[model samples]
Target: MDTTFPRLLLQHASQRSSAPAMREKEYGIWQTLAWGELRSLVERIACGLHLAGLGRGEHMVVIGANRPRLYATMLAAQALGAIPIPLYQDAVAAECVLPIVNADVRFAFAEDQEQVDKLLEIRPQCPQLSAIYFDDARGLRNYDETGLHALDALIERGADFAKANPAWFEAEVGKARPDDVAAMFYTSGTTGQAKGVVHTHRSLLDRAKAGADFDALTGDEEVLAYLPPAWIGQNIFSYAQWLACGYVVNCPESAATVTIDLKEIGPTYYFAPPRVFEGLLTNVMIRMEDASAPKRKLFHAFMEVARRVGPALRDGKPTGMLDRIKYALGDWLVYGPLRNNLGLSRVRVAYTAGEAIGPDLFTFYRAIGVNLKQLYGSTETAVFVCMQPDHQVRPDTVGVPCNGVEIRVAGNGEVLVRSAGLLKEYYKNPEATAEVKTADGWYHTGDAGFLDAQGHLKIIDRAKDVGQLADGSLFAPKYIENKLKFFPHIKEAVAVGDRREKVCVMLNIDFEAVGNWAEKRNLPYAGYTDLAQKPEVYQLIRECVEKVNADLAADEKLAGSQIHRFLILHKELDADDGELTRTNKVRRGFIADKYGVLVDALYAGRTEQFIETVVKFEDGRSGRVSATLKIDDARTFAPMKAAA
Candidate 1:
């Protein structure tokens, strides 16, 4: 199409001028913007930024929730031939400093007062940050800060600039080329400092169109933008794909209102990480646990049938008449209402990525008729490497290589990919770029897995994390941890058994789910710490661990990876505490280093271990959390046929 994002906007406005382009919820109401209106908005912002000294090739940072104004601001930056860098809005100010300094960002568009405060707090460290424009004007009216302006004011300035020079907008936008740098997304920095993943317009748009075509997405598809725009997956699904397919993108009012907004929008094309899906299912199950006996009984009876026959029906497979009748009845009585309740009733093609989803969780959606599938990709790949085709979704494998993507596995089991969608380079870090991208165009994915006989890609774990046990059998922590997380009561788990005699785990129980279970049994506790140490809770967690072990025993290769001992931590694994990445992926090595004492206790077969650790409070205060956490043993099943 030879299109930049701004050019695509112009085309849409020219072709489908009156069609809905974007919608946002505010004060409990949704306001829609048409394609023509969006084009005008982008032009005005572009001219305004141009007037504000934003020149071609300069970097502008975009940080905040998925607001329409923010999207326009990003396109506006690109319209001026400036590259837009998106940062995680939930990140601490210290984390933001590195990227801003690395990019030498001069102007930024923050969503609201909270985001503005973060930018201001780091202004001293980022002296080059000359201008700041905010979308929401809630708490900034009284502050007298230099170079701080409202987004409305920017638009007004843009309008005046446009009137004065009508040709300037088109001329600036015409300078943008398909191969120009479009956006920069930072890695999660699991091992070290985050790196800026640079992607050109050609790479992102090509993959966007490929995905949209594979799913047959069109303007009629509705998408809810809830995840942080900083993540490449969210950017691809909500931004690139929206422009590629000319779909209607909906922005939630706030994180708190995503569920309500999701239901109201009833998005047809949706994407979420595994954590979101797991949380939703946990909440639904918690509610079901509290339902009256008769209601629960009826729900379970129908759900059992859905679990058996729903996926077969969804995949257009053959089924006996009696089974079909039972499934139809179940859909009417249980599955239909459940899908509607989860805001997935209208979902035609939904995707989960970023991490492996549990089988039970994946099947639940498909079993209830939501075509939820898994995809495999990362920021460097423009987020589209593999996708499960229609009627071929499986929880075990991610999928076959998608259009324009070639995948191969190294002798060490690391997956490698070559695609037009691969990242151009890491900004200012050529050495690091050379490490991942080769001369022949293959990008080392660092994920360990191989293609099965059916050509499906099965991801085991990170190549660095995949290890062998003391007995020379293989061990994959993610494989075992995901099995534990499949149980709604277990929210997060980390397995440690690399080159060890046996595997042990530390986990965080889902507070809400456990609390509900406790309340139902008339058990009382004060808070997370008090509840987590309960003997009954430990027993509950141990049973979940044993179930996973039993499942592992059925697989010959993974049978040796069964968890032998486990403990429920006195605290949740949190990003603020540095136990997890911003995307909530566990930083396994960091956690191991931080809690070396606990890992030692688990291996030593201690029944209880007392430890006090420093924790960062939400308000930036530091305090100590002390607990004598109890460790418990779990039963490991013998494999049906053990590995040689």
Candidate 2:
């Protein structure tokens, strides 16, 4: 009858005692822990926290990269019936204050001295915050000892406590209920303050079970835990799924070193946002371009064979014996190594969520034999609403609702869902919660979508952002932006002019692709800001726009979204600048306000303009950058062909 997360650890430990639980790279070495060892670590940490006066319902914050200790602390909190709140290690001192205050976190297990200092800096402001425990003791020689405690020292103290009072830990865990709160996640608000989403143990477990039912993951599969633990996606993938399906979670050494760690793990289960996948594809293409001539020729030849047979196989089309044999040879000779190089050789069930994945990026992985599928969910829904099932996967749809989940579209095309995994409420924000949750208990997803005959959900865009042009045709920016992102030269795109003369857009060039083009032409640049403003870069973007226009013209469902005008911004949008969220979602309102002058220049009927913008550096310094802006008429394409 244990309701805490520690039971997940003990459950797997007993069932798969010898199975590898976590592997982290440190100082050019890979460190591993079997399931039994991982469970023991959690028990010791739990006993340590208990001896330090932490008890049931207390809050403990974990701040660090993906590591065994960080994960151990999470389970330790659950072992004592305490809630574990995860904070993004990269968040600045000011950004950390709100969540710390909201959770009323007094005890914290920080990865390094830097994070411990961040908490200490705001200790005066946060009345509930007191004790700070650090895993790495580097640079802490001068820190005060009143509240600072080294993890090693605490573990020594806990060993004595476990010998004296072993039953107390079990008693506290027994008090926890399935509906009792397990964690509080803070999601950045588009309008103002961050709201804490409270999730219960039942919510997490049900969500994980739904996900397992959706994809039918096996126990032998492995997952790479590289994304920020502050994200719900990471919580579900790294913790909940491990509990539900007994899959192993691989921890990367650090964010910068994920690629190398991924190669070593060769995980069977993978999940990433569209940007991450796009970057991976871009990097692979760049490396191939620099490969020897013979390797390049052989790679392309096999890819050609893959291009022909892979799609047919994916679609279950009939093929002759010779074509099947040729495909097998191509896979063994070319696609096999390509997958190995990208750390996807063992990928069985991969998923892309958080944003629409370009069809090209989607197909590339499938062409190489990875079952890359799309999923649809939000933080409020516990990240398990719909997922494309194996072999029934479609590029446009985000598969059927998961087990025990129900979804329906309102008359206005807004999606509504009801599931056991739904959040109880926005913590202390009943008014806001009441708005999103209906009296009948359906959670308004705020996304506009339709269900196909196959019962798959086809999301068009946000419900509010689905506007109409003067001709009354739908203008879905995300739909068009996904089309633009499919092009190699285009990286990020924003479509504007919803109710105006025509659909205009802004494009961010793929820096690596455009920078390489500049280098080959002997065009030198100081940085991204300078390179992006080059006149030749405008010509390059123009070609990309033309290509996207041609692709759109062929698709009748999206012909009205063709670009009519566009201008490249001098500076890239950064999350720290408030233009993007911590989750990497564009803050459309903030961007529109910050770049209002640039937007004006694009539609002012002028070919050229100048803009001066205030920029903020990571070190809390501010400056200004003024550059001449170039505006080009967005490429126009032929109208949709008459209905057959």
Candidate 3:
């Protein structure tokens, strides 16, 4: 058995010398990298870092979107026994800069000039940062510095060094150990400031190999590397899995062109957050509405059949010959083209993580034979905990504990996990480490959930967020919010009242769907902010909310979470307003502070009100907008009848 991941990489490279190891979209073309070439590239990069006045135990930070070079650099850092810290690219300068400074990163690999500029702006403040390297040199044509180096130039220099002193670099690579720090990732601090989660080579390698083993990966598997590299989910999928499986890792030409790149690559293995899947589903549904009448009818007809049989197929049940024929027709006429259009034609295995996936959303893909499975983990675990195995998958639960992972539910229902993949500690934050990891050894997941009869983990909500109604009924805000969002009309929702009178909600309507409906009715609106406040759109959303209420009332465990009242805010809840985090996650405390008056009005039985709020344009300009707010009465349904 291999003890170190680097050894496995070398072993695989030697075994599969000519196999395609990586595929990246460059200059509108798909580029293939063989195993030998990839291994060589990593080795050379590692050598370059060794030569750049860096040695064992140093720390390096990588910032930006996903790219092949980013993964190479991470491995290169590990190979040199240095720690690489990947920061979320979507994070604002202030949100991410502190971690880089705190980690004392001396050499940094920046994705582009924008990231380079951010580092430069803070260089004076960070005395430890000695050099900044940029992979993409698009806009930094004139920027000159004693410490800045372009990626290509570094690679060339590394090549020349390797030719001159081959044995010297080998000695450095030999210095790496299983317990050496490999990387440090900062968690998206939705509740507090981001803390660096530290991982060692053993922790990461164990999770990577377990993931590869679970998925039964082969070198032929192709994956699209597009999510933010700072996220552990993407890091595990793109870098760890790529290195473990020796598969072809494909990068999108750029973030903007991911869709085009996906269509071109048509990867065999795919992973996305529930939000990405939701966007794809919404895009298909929207296009269907605009398609020809025959096309629309045919699409719906086949979907109806798929809706019936997809679950059966996903559950591995026996469908009769007639249903099988219908499924075949649906796949050929409806599902095939639909999957192709969504760039999922060749997908063999798919995973969704970072949040809970709605059952309907999970079923829809599985019904179409997508093989999508849900997994459970966090940055602390190197992103491996419980994963639903193929053919035994369930949407409501994240499946059995992964290999080498031990999971147990604490008395209060918080999920506790212990595994080789657990992070070493939070960098410079011993207090946080002590708070999360108990003296007994279990790492508290903070999520409230339990294992089902089948030994699968079913998450309810955050342990801190799970509250009770005045009537002593359970109210899971996240579950209710997810149900509301399932409707195409509502984009996002915030369920209020932790211990107040009744549950009320603030909704952000889907602009595209609402805008299209408004256009059909000849209702003119300026933009998203304008469209959100439209009275006509308000009535439409009211109906959707009522339907959600009816559905919630039917569920005994969640009836108390039904929205008692709701309001369409004068403006959409935006990240720029401090109402949402950079990753689009709602900052509940921040939002409540910013919109205290508005939330108060919803519960106070106000029919309507006018408010002025500041809005930030995408260009970083600030402006004010005023609009009329509309409120709707709480929806109430008749009490459920007792079973006879």
The candidate maximizing lDDT is 1
Model 2, 183: alpha-carbon shift in Å? Answer: 1.2
Residue-wise C-alpha lDDT for candidate 3, range 53-163, written one tens digit per residue: 766788898888777688778778877778888877665555656887788779999999888887887787887889888999999999987799997888888888888
For residues 1-644, what per-residue lDDT tens digits would candidate 2 score against the true structure? 13446666777898889898877788878788898988777777889998788878877888988888888888888878888888888776678888888777889989998788778778788878778889988899788757789988887777677778877655655677888888878885654678888888888888887788766787888899999888899888988887777778888877888999899889998999988899898888777777799999988887877777776787677888888888899889888888998899988788989999887788888888888899998889999899887777777899889887899999999999999888889877899899888888899999999999989999999898888777776788878878888777777777876777677777778889878778868999988878987888888888888787887777776677678788887777777677778887767767777787777877787787788888878765788888887889866789769677
lDDT of 1 at 191: 86
Q: Estimate each model's TM-score.
A: 0.99, 0.95, 0.96
Better model by TM-score: candidate 1 vs candidate 2: 1
Ranking by TM-score: 1, 3, 2
The local distance difference test score of each candidate is: 0.92, 0.82, 0.82
Ranking by lDDT: 1, 2, 3
Error of 3 at 535 (Å): 1.8
Give the range where candidate 2 is weakest over 10 consecutive residues by summed lDDT. 1-10
Candidate number achieving the greatest TM-score relative to the actual structure? 1
The digit string of per-residue lDDT tens for model 1 on 5-82 reads 988998899999999999999899999999999988998998889889998899999999998889999999999989
**Can you tell me which runs of candidate 1 are displaced by over 4 Å?**
642-644
